[model samples]
Target: MNDLEEVAGLLAKPEPSEEVVARSRSRLQHRALGHGARGHRTLGHRMRSPGRVRWFVPGVALVAAGAAAAVVIATGAVTNAGAPAPVSGKEVLLMAAVSAERTPQSSGTYWHVTATWLDSEIPPMESWTSRDGKRWTRNEPGDTSDTVVPASISLRLKGADVSFDDLEKLPTDPEALKAWIVQRKGNPDDMSTSEIQGDPTLTLLTLITELPTPADVRSAAFRALAATPGVENTGAVEGGQALRMPDPDGLGEEIKMVVDPETARVVRANLLLTADGSSGSSDGDIAVTTDWTDELPATPKDRP
Candidate 1:
């Protein structure tokens, strides 16, 4: 099982209070995901074995410092009052978020599509790999135990985890974002070769680091966002607008997350990472298409 599934296992323990179970059921109903804090691994994990060849898995990088710097620089060079540019930041961002490939599919009353959440700007993260790691199986569409994750570096996937680091604690604050920047200082440009589309709303925090046991970049989020301002009430950001929870990421990774805008709770989250390179190229030409709706039953077999 993967970290999320494992986490599910933890919460699934016989003690899940009626309220907790109800809450989990509620998320499936309304579909809310909160945004906030957001991660990496290292050498030994980097170099491949004597006979194993290294393959470049897509997505996964800590872009907080660089991304935050980009934000601060953009905000600093702009006007604080009066009518601003017609390309209002809000419009630019909203346009970025809602744009996607597949619209929600409807089968009578049920709509089925992937869900993703946005809070503010997101943080950076990396993946890891390890021998003892059992490919924490999140098993997304087209994914399998053999899925390439640059494992030689000991990197992890977004929903995967290790004993030392828990994926559920991803952080989301300026200080933690800043600290992440420091931690990933050496990788300022270790980014993998990939590009994102300009018009689509991409979830920018999906990352890959290390190369063994698998890790989810978002796993490091909660702790980072614990001290963040504004997001506490869900209405403090963007002049009364909630913006998306766990907003953008410091790294440039872009994957969408869907959460109940009001409650910051996750209903469903999409994990496909788009590439910036040529879309028509073989293997690179693929674009993720997802959809979700309520009427469907919540049985284990009916899930996407």
Candidate 2:
């Protein structure tokens, strides 16, 4: 089996979250009840996921998976016996950028993304966007039917709305890309009391994983993330390495991502509430899959 396939199996174990955060099912249950009473909804459904952690929408949820016990990492590029060398967190991001740069340009009739919330109470969401971002097909959560609508659902980077053409023209150099992100993020100083501060890490992660940017642009994003402060490779885990970043919101939460370096794919990303971070019980999380596909589901007969 390939490396990512092997990592997927390792991820099936139930160890990572234990070391990360003690899950409080009771708190989740209580919050869920509160959501129901308040008529909270996931997009259009009545089931709520988690509050916006300043990085995502209220209905979006992060991904989750199991992790193994932390182990000593490799100190160099390779061992004397030729065994694979363990890499640092920064190294992992750099390597992922290389891999992303080597990816061939591709296209299909539709751009697909599947975002599965870690919370079991919420249903997964599937969406397909037309190449020009003028049409969309979405499988609504808790609804068996799928519908194609004449609506625009563009990919968002930071707070800027971008189309496929716009993504294609993004700067591929790390410095230029960083500047672009900062510009799109807007100035937080001008915001009122309700606006949340921007998290550059989250925006970079979204660019690399979710946006359909060119391979070189994606590589630049990875390189930018490697240089970001507080982004650390924690240690070895079962499926892959675990990388942690300080919670930008200062809400007593830490951001953790399990990534398979081989395929440059982020297996899961979660927000763990540290013991001293916050009294809140919700875990703001997001796991997403984005790709190009040719298959198009049927649309309503009456609507074009």
**Candidate with maximal lDDT:** 2
How would you encode candidate 1's per-residue C-alpha lDDT over 91-189 as one tens digit per residue?
212212221111121222221222112231222111222223322112121223223232222222221222323323433342443344333312212
For candidate 2, write residues 1-304 as lDDT tens digits: 4232222222333333321111222232233233223211233222111223232245443221100011223322334575433445665665566667777878898877665556545455566777766545453322344555433334444434567888888888777776666566432332211123434565566676656778888877777777766666766865666787766556445667766655566756663211111111125444556788997666676546
Give the root-mean-square deviation of each candidate in angstroms.
17.6, 13.8
- TM-score (C-alpha) between model 1 and the true structure: 0.25
For candidate 2, the per-residue lDDT at 205 reads 66
- TM-scores of the models, in the given order? 0.25, 0.63
For all candidates in order, the CA lDDT equals: 0.24, 0.51
Q: Top TM-score: which candidate number?
A: 2
The global Cα lDDT (0 to 1) of model 1 is 0.24
